[model samples]
Target chain A: MSDKLPRLEPAGLDGWIVRLFNDIDEANLSWLAALANRCRTAFGDALVDIVPSYTTLLITFDPLSLSPAEARDRLMVLLDDLEPDTSGVAGGQVHELPTWYDPSVGPDLERVAGQTGLTIEEVIQVHSGKSYRVFALGFAPGFAFMGLTDPGLDCPRLDTPRQRVPVGSVAIAARQTAAYPAATPGGWNLLGRTCARLFDRQREDLSLLKVGDEVRFVPVSREEFERQGGDITPLEERP
Target chain B: MTDTAIGVRVLRAGPLALLQDAGRFGVRHLGVTQGGPADLYSWAWANALAGNRWGAASLEVTVGGLELVAEKDLAFAIAGADLGATLDQRPVPLWERVVWKEGQVLRFASPVSGLRAYLSVRGGFAAEPVMGSVACVMREQLGGFDGLGSKLQTGDQLTVHPAGPSNNTATQQAPSGVRPDFSLEPVLSLLPGAQIAEFSGQSLYDAFNARWKVDERADRMGVRLTGPRLDCRVRSLISEGINLGSVQVPPDGQPIALLNDRQTIGGYPRLGALTPLSASRLAQCKPGQEVRLKATGSGAALQEYRAFRARIEDWV
Candidate 1:
């Protein structure tokens, strides 16, 4: 069992990269999360940063203060003491995002349906059915890559990605789905559009969701979206 | 406390300017970046000249074109780059301390020496710290004079504590000549990693022997180098955490040297990493500059690094 656990390798100059050999499954993610939380809670001062990804955690430290060998030894001790939490994330808030599946807003709905060999209605039904677990927030600020979608609707990414995907664009790639927090270039297939602002710079909390949060998209009518003060296009469209 | 102190009013803020201390560490899990002066050497010298303690917060000015007016009579030191700084219609010497009278204007033109400059006051700038640091990271929106990660702008009032007792002028002299001859090819030292065998022989030769050009698409996060394609036998691997100075070779075959603002994790295959000092030297290299990687033992690298740190400690 110990041999099956992830291994650590030298990263850049002053850090180490932990690699989990197993696939990105629930058990692996939970273990990774537990180890990360414990290590940070225990040695918060000595460690610079602990970045947890899909299957690994990167631990960085200041070489001037702490040597690489010392940091690795400490990490090894933490890993040995870590016990995988069985409760499956003690607390996670649920967020219901209102999404519109209109063709005009969802530019890649037909594309996703064509690739999945399912009707447009069937595509939307399968998408809105299951609740998604927020695996991580990365690539861009507030970009939440949720996971474990229904296998039936899973499809590959677009061959040539759109130069600029609109913000609030609900996208699907493989078994994962995400809401574009900000208008940026993306390759994911768009399935729907959302009026909810996933990221608000002015707001105290900035991000609508964080890692380990649960997300469920609720289908809404175009009128309801507009009534909710949804902009006709992104705020940056005029600019 | 002496009431006479030099204050500068922002006239034109360039791309980015922030109050930086050593950096806020031990907080990556909370999603905070370690923000510090881009050029640590110059920032240290500025503080040394002002007779301030190490880890003192100072202003890091990038790309020049920052204008400020002296609000009160104060002594300050400008170190690191020339930046074509002028005071009251007279050309001021770079990397030296000077007294500015109230209402005197200090202007910085385009970069004449280096990309970034450090300006230090006698007693470090008085700013409230966030999370045990005063360094500003815009992405995290944490740490700065206002603790909001907002860059200095026009009409913004900057407050500084009264200057303290000054020591005999700073002994460290700024290097003469233009910009440390960055045009010459840069030799970056790399310590091999665990996956050295994963790369092919040809790839290894090309990586160490070939000269790579700095790509224009470079930022604080990482600098991409364009050079001969290096092939790695290890095609797919588990995503792993990344570190500063990690040289990752993507599918495009170009090497990207991760820096201070890099992501916490990455998935690409890594050749190794540049030393911290090497990374700092590479940071000074402008785009289109040629760089070559030289593999060195970790023992030697660590010794050289400790010597460098000891020199900085002596000044303090």
Candidate 2:
């Protein structure tokens, strides 16, 4: 059964792909968390980066220091040392993010309600009810792909992507949810707004959400949102 | 100017200009793309000509139109594509070091040859490092002269302190052999990846045999090639870390060659990855320019890479 725990394959010159699972689920993420930890501990400086996504961990290394063959052998050895449960690495730091869930802030919130056949308040309640694990972070800096959102809130993306999605805009697409760390062209379904400064270059810890970190979204009032540097005005107020 | 004036000041900022070094490493896990010189070969040469070591930060000017005023007398080198560069309205030769007197103007006009030109100063450009690198990724807003990952704007001041005579490398000219002519079509080397077997046999054949035209919709993130639609049975998989030259195939079937400022992770199936040196060659390609891919074994690619590194060492 352990032999079927995915395999480490070579990726071009300076990277290795650790194919952990075929599907996205909690167990796969737990295994990924442990495997990523083991890779970091074993490879140390030789490892350039470990990109953890839904079911794969791509380990980029400095070829000048570590060869793919050696990296594969070491990783296999480390995998052997891990326990069967792999639950030791399951827990991660939980971060609570403050979000403004006004229909004005999230223009698509009403539309999502219409699609999911749930009340606006219920949508917000179910959305913020559970802790979401970050499956991956990409498309933009400090942008974490957190999921599997309440299946009830499942919604399709916009037919045509918006020219620009507001920064810190909390959005849901398919089963995953995220906040746009920076204003960029996005196609995700907008549901709310967050005042959390997801990324700050000045800080030693630049990104607010890491790959394995658990995230919880807490709703805030408009006054509280304004106080926390949210400068959004509703579309209806515009001329 | 202040009493201790250092480096050059932006006289005119062109379409796009950014400070780049080797790249930001060991941080992709945090969702940061590696920001570095798009044309690594040219960047290395510019640094070499400026008497700076490899991995030194240099100014990468895209589509030209950049002008700079030397605040202090310094030795600077221009390399990569010839962007109709001029010194005080006189033609300035590229791929060589030139002594820049105080207040002398160096201007780069529209591209006469290449899409990007590299300007390297002795002792490297002085920029505060973000996440251990001065490479500027505008999307990420990290690493640059301002440490905010901004492209060069007019009136932006860049700090540079030239090395003393003792530390300066005595070469003023880039060796003729390594200089690449950006005007010609490039045949890139592809290191076949795990997904290579997953693609259709005809698609694989077409990938190599067909000439992929560079689509206008290209940037630091990736270059979308308009050629054969590489059909693959596997559509999307679990997103994974993409490297500097990962050639990913989107649902549209067009291959987008990921570049220096590409996202940290991608879910699209990939045909393979371009060799590092091949990626540098592809960076010079302008919109509408055509390029082809040739499969290469890992051993052979490593040999070429090692040889290139050895050559750079010998140049120093």
Candidate 3:
């Protein structure tokens, strides 16, 4: 177990990046999550934030309370005795996001179809065909980075990111997919829009999707989208 | 608990004014970034000068043009960046506690020296906390005076918690030695990050010695530094959690130093990270201001930070 422990890289004066793996896989994410839990139990109030990304666990601690050497030593000890529980990750909850895939909301639907040499209908079918695992969440609140899209739907980011990718705009960059929890500048290829509130402060879990969850984009009608609380305000691409 | 709190009306909201505390902690896993005062030094000093405790909400006034009129007498302190503040047309001193009588106006003009100023009332401003914090993050639309992360606007009413009877004492002032002289270009201290060695030898040298100018592309999220193009072998990596002050160099070669409101993670190759105090110093710099970075070790950086925190912790 000690030999299998991930490498520790210095982030700064107060942070350490626990590199578990180099790729985004379910096993790596589960191990990172397990390590994150161990760190919290080990450090207690001394820890500031333990951010578990696809392949790394960035642990930040209170510099005042824990010195650099002390933090390293504790992490080493914790990792030596660690046993990752992959049970929860394998059986994680699946969330169905009702999506309205159309040119009205998904402006890049035609461009993506043209680039992929596939019909627009086929493109939508391919995207909605398989479920993606929620690898990580960042860039904005409740923005889940779901990944491993079908090879047929693989697309590059926009040459120039939009000034404002409207809220609920489901977009894809490379092999990853996510919905804009809020209106923000983004460079991902717009595929569709969803009405599900990805984030709400009033909810116990602020983010709708957590790491290790599965998400499927369920195609729906424009009227159904509106009925499900989707906003249909026309969006324009601005430089 | 229901006692009437003092009200402060915004006569002029200025460029950007938001309420901030230490910041929202223990919630980064939710993809939420910490939205604290860009200049922690000034915010802490202002709170200390007003005899307020740590985590007390303070107003961060940027590129000041804020004007306020209190409905009742209030005790407050202003610190960081000589913003040319005035009370009822009379000059208000910086780094010192002062009083604004009922109906008297307090105005902050454009920066005469610093880019941001902190205004902390004796009892701190009162607001409903969103996600256990009042630190306004406009990007996230969370945590502010209205608990909706809205910046101060003209005619907005701000509530201030009343100071206890114990706090009614003589005016306090921050020592002159402790105040930063924002006129001089800062030499920020950097701790070489994990990818420091990945850069070419020349790029590494230029990173430390080059005079980087503060680019106009700056905000609470991050500040871009324009200088020599720092070429790195690695174009990108697995996106990892980005800490405050992480100086990541994109393909364009310019380094963007992540700040308080930066995204939770990034994949660009990082040259290094600025110390927290250095980040606070850089936050006060105006656009096009020349600055340099000096490499430092974690031990020395921690020592300096601990000393600064100790000094503030000693304050009431």
Scored by Cα lDDT, where does model 1 land? 0.73
Given candidate 2, what's the lDDT at residue B53?
Answer: 84
Lowest lDDT sum, 10 consecutive residues, model 3 chain B, at B162-171
**Candidate that would win on TM-score:** 3
lDDT of 2 by residue, B7-107 (tens): 79998998999999999987888888998999888999898878888899999999998999998888788998889999889998888888889889999
Q: How many times do residue backbones clash in model 2?
A: 0
Candidate 2 at residue B2, lDDT? 26
TM-score for chain B in model 2: 0.96
Residues A1-239 of candidate 3 have per-residue lDDT tens digits of 13343888888888988887877776676687788888989999999998878888889999999987789889988788677758767767799999999988899999999999999899889899989988888999888999889877889999988989999999887888999989998999998999999998999888999888899999999999999999988787553
Worst ten in a row by lDDT for model 2 chain B: B161-170
Model 3 CA deviation exceeding 4 Å by range: A1-5, A237-239, B1-4, B167-171
lDDT by residue (A58-79, candidate 2, tens digit) is: 8888776766677778888877
What are the lDDT scores of the predictions, listed in order? 0.73, 0.85, 0.89
Better of 1 and 3 by lDDT: 3
Q: Where's the lowest-lDDT run of ten residues in candidate 2 chain A?
A: A82-91
What is the lDDT, from 0 to 100, of the residue B192 in candidate 1? 78
True-contact fraction per candidate equals 0.49, 0.68, 0.75
In model 2, which runs have C-alpha deviations exceeding 4 angstroms?
A1-5, A84-91, A227-229, A235-239, B1-5, B166-169
